[model samples]
Target: MNRVVTHELIHAFDHCRAHVDWFNNMKHLACSEIRAANLSGDCSFGNELSRFNFGLKQHHQQCVRDRALRSILAVRKVSREEAKLAVDQVFESCFNDHEPFGRIPHNQNEARFAYRDFQNRDRYNANL
Candidate 1:
């Protein structure tokens, strides 16, 4: 629950910080959705296992990509072909933009602010 909330909070923060027009910006929307799906446990192994309800099995990455695809399509409000094209366009970059984790931020300003905030929180926690 906390993880999902924080994930969404990060998206909302991204929108505010980047002045993202979520409804129209296909790339921006896809990028954020990709991040949220990758980070939010939507694609986690445990989560996928829990979501499964049948005999046939599938690869974990496939499950993750499918979920990510559905999420992107939902947000883009476009046909599957269009959404897939848009997602495919930014797939590599967005999938690689995992913040506060393995991937790097595409925007330097976002990285700087995130690093600063992380340091501040670390300092405050150490004091406590």
Candidate 2:
């Protein structure tokens, strides 16, 4: 039996790359909470991005790849009823235990409401 890996369904927000962002060729669309909530371990989209090429035509391709790497480092799992505890834990470690992002919120429910609201607004408008 062969096991095929399906990457955790996620919404990624890649930073703006020079020409790609300008032309809107590359983008980070937010991942789906419904799909991402069920994922285990480090979630990923699973495509192998090729290493950067050099010379005038490809000089900065590596930089573009690097941006993607930095962006992926902050991902956290979502919860069904609230923002997952795992998120704060992961973000905290990434920020070296910074107070705000690292600190656990007083209410997980509020976080879910806020995150959902933002996501819904984005989805609602995106439909139009």
Candidate 3:
């Protein structure tokens, strides 16, 4: 439930902050999915282990790409090849765009901390 909310919130955040052509642009959708997967803890170590996808080098990235690919497939009428291509095209940039979180939250505790920091961002900025 939390993961789902986090993933969708990422899409909503992108929608509000950027000119995302969700219906007309596969790249835009791909970018959001990559960001969601990377930043929402969808590729966290525990999640990957639960899916029997741990231990490999760069597993987080591979998981993000795979999740983004699955998400694109689920929501779009694109071919696997096309979806994969789109994900691959935007993976590097989107995966690195941490934005509001500032960094990837790899677990629940980290996510909670990030949420706290996010909530206090205005206070931090006001102090600055």
Candidate 4:
């Protein structure tokens, strides 16, 4: 439940902050999907491991890409290869754009800390 909310919220946040052409732009959709998967704890270590997806190098990244590809396919009427291409095209930049969290929240504890940091970001920025 929480994970789903967080994932959709990331999409909402992205939509609010960017001129995302959701219907026409595959890259925009792919970027948001990558960000959502990467930032929403959807690809957290525990989640991945429970899904029997672990032990590989760069597993987190692979998880994000796989999840993002799935998400794009779910909402867009596109071929799997096209969705994957879009995800791959924007994976690096989108995966690295840790906006409100400022980092990837890999677990519940990390997510809590990231939320705290997000809540206090304005204070930190004001001091800068």
Candidate 5:
């Protein structure tokens, strides 16, 4: 397959995965149009994923923390939330004294601040 196709598919897949996971957990049925579009095409994949305000926003926000996932993801031309998720997985994997895939913030100090902030924010939002 062409690299561009791969890129598009990857983006599409990320959009689908993010929104699907988001809605599946939250049951945000109202977002069907945006979710379906995300699954089907790349038209709003980057922007929507970056600005998506549905099911998984807190998770995405937690993962991104204070860091600009938009910029990081733009470098790879991937969705912002996708980058945040990558960072989330990093936290899940690197966190000590917790469940695997559990979103605990830890690691390199300077950079970890972002992860920590994200973790705290998610916790705060969840409680609200």
Candidate 6:
């Protein structure tokens, strides 16, 4: 779906802009994966239920964290402890940092192609 594509696109965009060594930088990789999983609707209740059943109604934050952790561990090939440390180190910062939805740019030239921004711009231009 569009969400998944946009999520990976953000990773691509970040790699392009930062020239990050994704293969080696476990922290950076984990951070981006967490952001993508959380922001890209991968952790939505409906999405989760579609993939696996959750008997109890857990908090959304827990669901998001679980989803993010799974994604982070999938790559970087790091031990669980290392991945957990990295995820914990960056979780607060990356999880809160979202584009379009949370438009407080970290810098002057934040990426403008996020889904929310595109939609907002489209709607605004439509009336003009």
Per-model TM against the reference: 0.66, 0.17, 0.86, 0.88, 0.21, 0.68
Off by over 4 Å in 2: 1-57, 76-128
**Which tens-of-lDDT digit does each residue in 1-128 have in candidate 3?**
88889889999999999879999999999999999999888888888778887977888888889999999999999899999999989888898899779778887687788888888878856556
Instruction: Give the Cα-based TM-score of candidate 5 against the true structure.
Output: 0.21
**How much lDDT does each candidate structure score?**
0.64, 0.27, 0.89, 0.89, 0.36, 0.67
Candidate ranking under lDDT, highest first, comes to 3, 4, 6, 1, 5, 2
Flag the better candidate by TM-score, 3 or 5. Answer: 3
lDDT per residue as tens, model 6, 21-74: 787787788777777776666666566679784546654556656766777777
On TM-score, the leading prediction is 4
**Clash pairs, model 3 backbone:** none
| Stretch of 10 with least lDDT, candidate 3 | 119-128
lDDT (Cα, tens digit) per residue for candidate 2, span 15-66: 2221123122212212122122212112212211233223455323223233
Give candidate 5 regions above 4 Å deviation: 1-64, 93-128
What's each prediction's clash count?
A: 0, 3, 0, 0, 0, 0
RMSD vs true structure, all candidates: 8.3, 17.9, 2.3, 1.9, 15.8, 7.5
Model 1 worst lDDT run, 10 consecutive residues: 101-110
Error at 118, model 2, angstroms: 29
lDDT of 4 by residue, 37-82 (tens): 9888888878877988786789889888988998888898899999
Off by over 4 Å in 6: 52-58, 100-128
lDDT per residue for candidate 5 within 1-128, as digits (tens), equals 33235334533554565444433322222122222222222222233356663244454333223233433444455566665565454443222312211222222352356556556666656557
- Candidate ordering by TM-score (highest first): 4, 3, 6, 1, 5, 2
Question: Candidate 2 overall Cα lDDT vs. reference?
Answer: 0.27
